[model samples]
Target chain A: MRAAIFRGAFAIQVEQIPDAALLEPTDAVVQITHACICGTDLWPYRGQGPYQPGWQIGHEWMGIVQDIGSEVRTIKRGDRVIASYDFCDGTCEFCLQGLDSACVQGGLWGFGHEGGQAEAIRACFADATLVVVPPEVEGDEALLKAILPLTDVMAAGHHAAVSANVRAGGRVAVIGDGAVGLCATLAARRLGAEQIIVLGHQPQRLALARQFGATDIITSNGDEAVQQALEMTQGGAQAVLECVGAKETIQMAVTLSRPGGTVGFVGAPHGQEVPLGHMFSSNIGLRGGLAPARAYLPELLAEVLAGRLDPSSVLDRTVSLAEVAAGYAAMDQRQAIKVMVRP
Target chain B: MRAAIFRGAFAIQVEQIPDAALLEPTDAVVQITHACICGTDLWPYRGQGPYQPGWQIGHEWMGIVQDIGSEVRTIKRGDRVIASYDFCDGTCEFCLQGLDSACVQGGLWGFGHEGGQAEAIRACFADATLVVVPPEVEGDEALLKAILPLTDVMAAGHHAAVSANVRAGGRVAVIGDGAVGLCATLAARRLGAEQIIVLGHQPQRLALARQFGATDIITSNGDEAVQQALEMTQGGAQAVLECVGAKETIQMAVTLSRPGGTVGFVGAPHGQEVPLGHMFSSNIGLRGGLAPARAYLPELLAEVLAGRLDPSSVLDRTVSLAEVAAGYAAMDQRQAIKVMVRP
Candidate 1:
């Protein structure tokens, strides 16, 4: 089997690795048909965070369950499925509360487990960790592409909306123009937010934001963006979705929220610090974190399958397993919103 | 008229001042019958935050309506009423959303306006800023004491519970055993939280917490309290009400919240810093701030009138206007949980 391995900063290589196999009865081998490079992948790709030299490197994929261990009951061979970015048993106290990311016995992918950007990968806690794809739509290329993001970004976007308590007829402001941010715009719309203001720096992405139900867009950065958002929303939005987790972005998210409003952030924090003073004086709230993708996958999948959601547009480029390095470079350089990997 | 004046650090003096009179058509004057020394008042007394010397002090009180401006409609002369700590018009966008503290035209007491500790106060936005006392209950000393906290602490505590989303059968933990923390315990019990854990440093306050419906009490401080709360909760609380706004207490609140749970804080932050890294990784949420006491006063008042709530016990000591300086010292030294002031 071949997998995308992190060699060093700006260096990724698809090399032959031992085939993924069932090491436990609760595990199943998924033959990856689709995978993607995430904004989070850029963290390690740019050497921004600690990453082992030779670790597996993908956590978003959907594939056919090629094999399952004897004890796996809910899923069997040949079944199509998509595993959440993080795996959970769905029975732990955390998982029961829909906080799958913090499941007591769960863990993230590409750490000790097989990477998703490979020919095949071992999925533990098969029944709870994997959401089976509908049999009728299994091989539809466009449909599969649309469903792919449900594994992470789409669910995360929904998490931001849910955490922020976006409601019908309410106003919302979304910070960031990344794939997750775009998805959040769509999610906010689905949640019935009447006004969706998207703040971003990219012209093309901002245009896409409009298509994804953003009623307004601000192309400025930093303080300028906050000013524009606050002015447009008349004081500030009722709910602000922070899809970018940088310090400035988080601060802007808080600043653009109305007094007594909430900021729901899902961007993986690097140097984010919540402005407690501002939040305290304004009665604003801060919520959201690593989204429980597993908990939201099914609902988002239904929306995709029903043709109401189409986040595949976020995947603007594609690459083969051997060219996964270029895929990372494209995303790192902002040349592509997201790069889908066909293994 | 006479009022409590802030002379300097560790200095409070009663001084003769101009009688309270309406400055705006929307204002009404109230003759103070009862007032209270708040934990917040200690800030200026201890010289912690910015405070103007010779400025009036105190913001929690209930009294008979002495006079009303031409435009004042809802409240009239001789009607007993309680004013929220902050005055608002109750018609602003923020106020309509139950955020009276952030009212567009609202302002805190004791800045330019006469403080509650004065013999009389000019209550602005009379129709909205004051909750009229039921005629039948007027002049009832015990009932008035029970209802006085509704002017601030009780309503603020209910705000914590409300902000934290305390629900029936939910597990809750309250940080701080001050008047507000005790009231939060009562609010949590009213909200139907099954397990109410009160964390504080004082045994007497903890005892009061139990009387207010705290099912468990932890007197430990800092990391030890977090550990005990985690162990006792089997993980962490589903809802945590942060009544103390210090940095260490804020961190403890975050550390003791279950993943996906929320910490509703009402403590005026001194040097509070929310640990975003821990919150992000654990999926914990932070909310609450200067509570909208006016929004919650009516509901809490009704509870008191029905014999279902009584928070007056928190006022263990009482002082006349001339002894208000000593009252501040007593609370500062933790000699009294809360001190009542009669003008």
Candidate 2:
């Protein structure tokens, strides 16, 4: 089966890997129908994150269940479903607490398990890890790309909004213009933010941010961006969502928030250190971690099916599974916002 | 007038000083009736925090309004009131958001104004900074000690609980056995926590913790405390209150909380740095800063006035204004939980 593999830094390849098989009673095999290159995928491609020479590389995926182990009772063969990046046993204490990201036995798809950018993938904890697409929209290709976001990015954006405590009529500042940031802008809007502002310099991405519910955009950085946000909010935003994990973005999140507001960060932080005294003096609340995507699936998926959210606007380009390297290169070179692949 | 001054490391002296008088139209002078030596006060006494010899040193006090500036409308001469450690304008955006600690014109009691550990204090923002003692309990000394906590420690503890999102049926673990920790135990109970645990080795402080509604006590530190907390909670406490600003206590607060729980801290952290990756991977929510005591006052003061909440048990000793140095020495030597100064 053809799958995406990390050959080296700046080198991702579409190569034939061993086929997946049911390894446990709780496991299910999924035939890859659609997949996409994620922002995190660019981490290794840019030599920013861990680089393994030969490991399966994608996590966001949606496909049809080709087969299931005996223990899988809720899902069966040939059902379209979205599998979140994280797989967890639904009954663990952490899972029950809506912290599936910290589930004792949970595993991220690209690590320990096979990558989703393949012909088929084997998923453990199938009953608790997969969410079936509503029947009415399952056959549409456009809807496929839209629903695929629920597997990771959209849910992550929702987590950022929830962490920042975004509410109806609240104001939010989204830092970063990546797919996740755009999704967060949209999520904050769906959560009823009266003022949605995006801070980014990229023209194409910023345009998408506006379409996704950003009421304004500041093509600036540092204190300049902060000033614009404060001026727009008439003081400072109630919530600041840091979607890019860079230290600069994190600092900007703090700078853009009001004294009593919150900053929610979902990006994997890089060299970020919080000045305790400043955070204390300002009474700013910092929250957010890995998204409990599975925990948010049912509600967000309903929004997607109801046509209330169209997250696939982030998918600016598409390709066949065999041309996966081109997909990675395009996003890496900033030639495309995101890439979708049909297997 | 006379006031305590930081003479040098491990040295404080009660010496003759200029009397407090109203200078600003928003100012009001208070005749110090009672004051308390704070845990933060011991910082300079033990040579830990910034040491400025001869600087006015106390921040918590309650007294009768001695005089008022022409603009001071809320408080009048001869009225009993509590002067909190923080002075906020009460009309700023941050103040209106219930975050008086972050008020734009706010300043600590001793910095830009006279410290309260003197015969009198000149308080700024009088209308917003002082809360009147209920008429029914004005002359009650026992009730005075109880209501005094509402000005600082009790309100700070309540901030920790509110920051950690403690709710009915939740479990709480309070680290540090100082006045703030004991008060946090009381506040968590008031916030409706089902179980409360204190982690400290001081027997007397632990006894006070129980009296303040702690259900259990763990006299350990480091990983040992973590293991015991895990065992007691069968996982971890729902909320961990870090009242000690040391590096070790902050780490314990993170280590002792459940995966999805929050750690609320009110201590003025001394050079603390967070391991962002560990906190993120664990899905622990860290929320806390300086407490907005003024926002929490009316409710807590009501409880105190109603004879439902008593926070003065932590005040284990008393001293006259002339014996201020002795009060500091006793508290610095761990011979007293807290010292109540009668000016």
- 10 residues in a row with least lDDT, candidate 1 chain B: B268-277
Give lDDT tens digits, candidate 1, residues A1-343.
9999988899888899999999999999999999999988898899977878899989999999999998899999999999889999989988988889999999888865678999999999999999998798865899999999988999889999999999999999999999999999999999999999998889889989999999999888888888888889888998999998888888888988999889988987766356788898899999999999999988888999999999999999999999899999899999999999999
Per-residue lDDT of model 2, residues B151-173, tens digit only: 78988898999999899999899
TM-score, one value per model: 0.97, 0.93
Stretches of model 1 off by over 4 angstroms after superposition: none
DockQ of 1: 0.67
Cα RMSD, model 1: 1.7
lDDT for residue B324 in candidate 1, whole number 0-100: 98
C-alpha lDDT values of all predictions: 0.91, 0.87
Q: Mark the 10 consecutive residues where model 1 chain A has the least summed lDDT.
A: A267-276
DockQ computed for model 2 against the true two-chain complex using alpha carbons: 0.62
Q: Please report the candidate that would top DockQ against the real structure.
A: 1
Q: Relative to the unseen true structure, what is the C-alpha lDDT of residue B245 in candidate 2, on a scale of 0 to 100? A: 77
